[model samples]
Target chain A: MKSDSDILTTIAVQFAIMSFLALGGANAVAPEIHRLTVEVHGWLTDRQFADMFAIAQAAPGPNVMIVTLIGFHVAGMWGAVVATLAMCGPTAVLALYLARTWDRFKDAQWRVAVQGGLVPISVGLIGASAIVLARAASHNWSAVAITAITAAFAYWTRWNPLWLICAAAVAGLAGLV
Target chain B: MPEPVSPPAPAAPIPSHAELFFAFFKITLSGFGGTLPWTRRMFVEEKRWMTDNEFNNVYALCQFLPGPNIVNLTTVFGSRMRGPTGAMAAWAGFLLLPFCMMIAVGLLYERYGDVDVARRLLSGIAPAAAGLIVATVAKMATPMFARFGPAPFVIVGTAFAIGVMRWPLLWVLAALVPVSIALTWWRRR
Candidate 1:
């Protein structure tokens, strides 16, 4: 077991790495994080890692919640606190700096180029995240059907998502999830 | 006859840094579930800090960066209004609140994650989580299609092909980036 200081140090380092390289969101760095957690730190097994990821995503709020959950698993309450703050704090500072300078080039050609370039990149990352989630969640035909129907209904109708979530919860309780 | 060159318009009296900070803080704290729709309502319909096109442009830029897109967009918007300090305040308010909540949940989860009810609750929630993702996709796509048309569709199609088909995302991006750039350049020309 790690001491509190060690855990805090680890949290700080991991948070910095994740914050800087979290391009496209937490999901974008997921494959690397999976490697670090399961392979390097041995904090959790691959199966446990996958399960926590599911729980984090299923829970309401930001995807960075995974960092806190994983830290809690590795250490304890302090780990969660350290990890969450570490993950959010430095990036918040950097975002502030970037925001300050953004106005100077409001009409620059490179600004338009960068903006146009990001559209496809975001689409690709979101698509990749969808596929990863599908593979993790859809273990059986029933689960597959749930996924498909959820996608279809959301794509087609104006139904509130809370209702669909409720339906799925009921389905899972019935051993269909 | 020679045309006269017009002088640039004077900048509007923008919000004070503190005002900008609080406005963004409010936006972040109140927005839950999917935030895009609420963000549109606030920025476009309510505060009118930016036009729809400007908001979309900033959003597009944020998406390419790492971290949460909404948080990043908040940084950009806050920065536009009040400079770096405002951006920091907005990001801190937005991320700090959510992080605290998530950490609380994580603590509870660590203590009681293996409980049967917890397991059952999570299992039930998984499908709902999937639905939320779909909801987010639709919410984003609507304004995208309405405003930009074929471009967004093309981006989606390319993404599906690369991600679902297991084609290399880098290669797909490589091919499309130039095409998108070329099209924009041609249109400008």
Candidate 2:
């Protein structure tokens, strides 16, 4: 079993890595996170990772819940605390420091370039995350169908996704997923 | 017809650090899964702490950095409102409650994850998650499309290239950034 210190160190290191690469959102680091959790740390399997991601989504808060879950897996309750704090702390500090000088360069050209440069990269990262999740979760034809249909509905319609989620839940209860 | 002239008024005073902390604390607790748009509504439109342009600019910067986007955003907004202290308060308030909830859920899951009912419940929730991701993509895309003709199209093309064509993400980004910058610059000129 992993020791408490080791777990805390892992959590801190993971968050530090995530803090740096989480460009765009939590999704941006999802692929890397998966690699670490499943491949490197041996903390969880790919399916378990996907399941935790689903839990994070179903929960009514930020996507950072995955950190909590992974932490719990590694070292129980305290691990959860360490992981969440470690994940959020650095970014908060960075944002604070950057905010101090943000106003002075509001109209700078590099700012515009940075903004322009990041949008596509963020989109690309999010898209990559989708592919990774789909690969992990799409174990059966039904799961694949659900993924494709959800993507289609979202892309084409304005229907609130809550209904689809409920429908999927019902289907899963009926052994559809 | 005589033009109506408005009387000159004093500018609003900057909010105090305490007030900024409380306001962000509320935003952090209240905001749920789809935080970006709601954050825009609160900070840019309702509170008027920052202009839409400012929010967009800051959001762009936050995106390139690490961690949860909203957490980064809260820090930036809080720091702007006060200083590092305000930023810490905001981060604490925003994170503390959610972290508690997630831990509780995690504990419960650890205990019962292998139970049949729990398995069924989790399976049921998976599709809902897929739907949520779709919704998020739509919500994020709509605003990007609303501004600058062809920008939306470019975003869509980029999404398709990345999503369906399996294009290398970096290469796609490499191609699109300059194209978007050139188009925006040319249009502005």
Candidate 3:
């Protein structure tokens, strides 16, 4: 009873904190989200997390929609709304304020170093996300094959990513994966 | 090279609040692969609101700030145009359609996500989605590895700590960011 409300509150608070730490984007925090939801709380499984990621990617929006789906999964409609807002709202307001002073420091040395520093960490966080998600998404030999082939094609070619997703879906429906 | 924010080249008309909203709404709808490129087109190409230089500067700023880079770009760009409320308008427009779409998708997933067919379909999509992320990381990393430095170690250390070690992220960043910045600062100096 009370625990339900507490859960939502926790979700809101944690997501708010995550927005600040989300260096590259929501993708950069994928590992962190996985840790909190699937590990710390046991609210979701690795499989469920991967599924939500797939659904969000399939939708035509920012990858941040994954947070919306997770919120909805945990606590229904209001949960969804709260998570999305928590994830986006505070950072947005912060961005509004920061934009004012940012232009003045456009070429500041500290700014350059900060950007340079965060760049590697951001890429690494994203890399961590890829590894964590790949482990979750791969369930069998065929699934591993799908991940490998998709990664190869996506890296080597310029075909639209949507096509790869579509092919993967068809293969799945056909029981090939 | 980084430059001061200046309205160089040709200046496009400053967008009204409504224009700001619609431009982003249209970009969200048009974006399939990703919104960033489409945003670049609309702001710099079609609308001419920003020169390429101006856009790049904003990109650098938004990327530096925490949270979603694209979402922050909308806020920063909007605020620049018409102050805070302008920021609200752009943010709302950018998120409105996607938010609705996600809710609807969420509802459907809640109902049917575990059904056998849907499960199979999702199982298929999941791995490929993960694959796409791998490819994305590769592309982002290739540029960094062009010259060997502490960056590769930073990347591997962070990845191992979080992805494998599953360390609490905030603590990891607290430790890593300052050291990483200092190294970069010394290098740049």
Model 2 pairs whose backbones collide: A24-B63
Worst 10 residues of 2 chain B by lDDT: B1-10
Q: Tens digits of per-residue lDDT for model 2 on B32-72?
A: 54556667776665667776566766776676665688888
> Where is model 1 chain A poorest over a 10-residue stretch in terms of lDDT?
A116-125
Clashes of 2: 1
Q: Can you write out model 3's per-residue Cα lDDT over B59-119, one digit (the tens) per residue? A: 8778767898889998888887888889999999999998888889888888998899998
lDDT of 3 at B91: 91
> What is every candidate's C-alpha DockQ against the true complex, given to 2 decimals?
0.34, 0.39, 0.80
Model 1, B10-105: lDDT tens per residue? 234566677666666566566554556777667666666666666666775566665656667777777776677767766665566656666677
Which candidate comes out best when scored by lDDT? 3
Deviating ranges (above 4 Å) for candidate 3: B1-11
Give candidate 2 misplaced runs (Cα > 4 Å).
B1-25, B44-54, B134-189
lDDT of 1 by residue, A1-177 (tens): 667798779877977766665656765445546657776788887556656765666555566678878877777778777877676666656655655565577787766665555564455455555655565566677777877787777778877665676677678767766
Full-model lDDT for every candidate: 0.64, 0.70, 0.88
Error of 2 at A37 (Å): 0.5
The true-versus-predicted C-alpha distance at residue A6 of model 1, in Å, is: 3.3
The collision pairs in model 1 are A22-B66, A23-B66, A24-B66
The complex in candidate 3 yields a DockQ of: 0.80
